[model samples]
Target: SLILTESRSYWLASLTFLLLFSLMSFRSNKRLILTSAFILLTAGAVISQVPVLKDRFHSITDTKNNGSNITRLMIWKSHIKAFTEDYTLTERIFGAGDNASKLAWRHFGRAFQEVTGKEEIPPPGELRKWFHGGETHNLYLKFLTKYGILGLLGYLFFWIYVIYRNLERRDSLFIKAFVAGYVGFLVASFFENNFTDAEVQFTLFFILGVNFALISETAVRQR
Candidate 1:
């Protein structure tokens, strides 16, 4: 399903999860490692042989052929530009408030037009298509744009704390899987607004809740 989606981020994320989880769980078993490698290679070969998937995978780094990638770059550019240039000091610290990126685009949107020498404003249709109403398409950038430095820091700290808790009680395989999933989510967040994605959030938080419950159960057992 992930392969069929043709989403580069999801592919990378799933691969990262597989690699990390395998390393953490199966690294000591030579037979399992060999089997896993063979399976992964076979899967990769099959995926690469499919023309649609093959082209899409190759186009990930093909600047000229990927319009969506180029658009993502522009969106990222505008976001960074807005954060650096347009945000006030208070706004930078506390954020310009929720959904402020929508308004911030007005400033960087003109900057983009000036640089490209195109009238990129007020068709409403094109504007909506181009900016997607100020979505940075990046979880980190989205957090920064919505909640400022403090908010971004708080978010990062929360993740770090969760990982720390997992490490503190490192006996559970489920906890290791949670860590792997978190790493995959981090990779996906670079190319997506996964923070606001309901499905992703639900899965992530569900795993997280289970992890916490497992941790508490272990503590009770130890006591």
Candidate 2:
């Protein structure tokens, strides 16, 4: 499970390598099989230890965040109310921009404090200072508010293109495996704002791009 937590991509990549090695080993390519397995294993081990790297790996898996998780859901519910109050086609498509976060903070913070009976303040030290405005914790909503409907459409389109181009090739098992893992990550992003988190976004895009490249190579070989 820990290994699974480390990286969905790595796990998928390792599986692909193992499958390929198993299939090709019968051809007496002992050295090639050993080299590929060793390299993949080393990479997976090293990546699991790096702080940011590990976060990306874990992002693909669902983590229980205790009770604190509901705050965002509550905030989202409140946001829906605010959006309904306005209910303009313009607001729905273009959004109210940074103002939405402020509105959410005021409503959600007050509610949170009232319910929990705790005064909310920024945390101690640099982290608090850096984040002058508290986070919404929902990347899709954040982008929607900031960039509007057109931006959301463009963003989704880009990912769709990436997935389509990468997974279209049938020749490479590695590409196929990576795409499978990526699809999992994409699904998780709906519930969690995975793209807003730097670590998650980086790992997701990197693997997607890598898979695309692998697929391209395989297509070339088949031609």
Candidate 3:
């Protein structure tokens, strides 16, 4: 259900991490993995030249965002406005509730109109058309609106800690793989909702778990 560009970003980033791992690996199978990746990358690039497939290349840097990005921008602006002007101190400090931004947008539709200088309320059908299914596309903003500064700080530091933990040991193949994958995930997350999507979130945790296992084994070996 994700955009083609988004899926490409995720998988390409993963493949890149794996490819680098193979290049650096001493294992016998590294050559096989490298050969396979090269073939697929080459085939995929050639296929993109087909008339039906060329638009995807433009989509990679499309500032207009194929319509979705503008809608996201509007929703983000609306949410930031509502969070600042429409909520109580307690609600502001602790957020309205978990997964409640959509609800906030619904309840605070008037606030959005006021902030955006559009006084007309859409019909119920129209409401579903424009505002439904929108979340804070950016996770930091989501945290700021949901759980205030403390939550935002915690969220930021969590990744910092993860990166630090991985780097504490000598860089091994698995460690390099996780770091590269995690870096890509972070970059993609800024533009999309990685946490809300089940598959993306699952893959994120899978990366974390692999890193944990790798780091633990390395620690045991050192002992």
Candidate 4:
């Protein structure tokens, strides 16, 4: 799936989740730990041998040549500029409401254009396509742009709260896996709006539900 999507975010996040989960779940099993490490190394070696896949992987850091990377950077820059420059004090604190990043983007973009007769990095129309219902390609920035600092803090708190609840029953491998997957999601969120992606969101929340279920079952067993 990572190769097919050619998503650097997916690759990094999957590796993070797999490594963390394996270490946590098999910490006491030296043989299993060694086996997992070998398997990961073998997979990485095989991936590096594939020309197309190898190039895609390497291109993750090639902002100059990688169109996607460049575009992502530009999107972040433009939206952040919009938020800082065009957004009002109230908007900065509480956001401009849903789907308002585009408004902010356009407002600043057009003003910049009028003053300099030059288009912004993403250009308003091009950015509109990428929105996909308020996706700024970065979850943190997305919240900051549309939901403001308060929203961002709330979102972070929700994740922290869930992770804390799961950790209270740290013996459950299932709960540990849930935490690992969420850590992966947070890493992925740095580069993609995984939270806004419906399929990803569904899977994420479903696992979260199972995490709580496991925690509940353990509590009941203890009682």
Task: Name the lDDT value of residue 22 in candidate 2.
Answer: 44
Better of 3 and 4 by lDDT: 4
Clashing pairs in 3: none
Cα lDDT tens digits for candidate 3, 1-223: 2223445455555555555556545364566576758866774676476654466555655545455544555667667776766777877777766655654565545644553456887676765555646576777777777787677788879988997898787357567666656666666566666766889678878868877988999999989
Kindly report which residue stretches of model 2 are placed more than 4 angstroms away from their true locations once superposed.
Answer: 1-66, 109-134
Model 1 weakest lDDT span, ten residues long: 108-117
Candidate 4, residues 36-104, lDDT tens digits: the string is 688678768867888888898888889666766655665666677788777888888898776465664
Residue 86 Cα positional deviation in candidate 1, in Å, after optimal superposition: 0.7
Look at candidate 1 and give me any clashing residue pairs: none
Clashes of each: 0, 0, 0, 0
Query: By the TM-score metric, which is better: model 3 or model 4?
Result: 4
Lowest-lDDT window of 10 residues in candidate 2?
Answer: 123-132
Which residue pairs collide, candidate 2? Answer: none
- The candidate, 1 or 3, that scores higher on lDDT is 1
TM-score of each candidate? Answer: 0.86, 0.55, 0.68, 0.83
- Each prediction's RMSD over C-alphas, in Å, is 2.9, 8.1, 5.3, 4.0
Model 1 whole-model lDDT (C-alpha atoms):
0.78
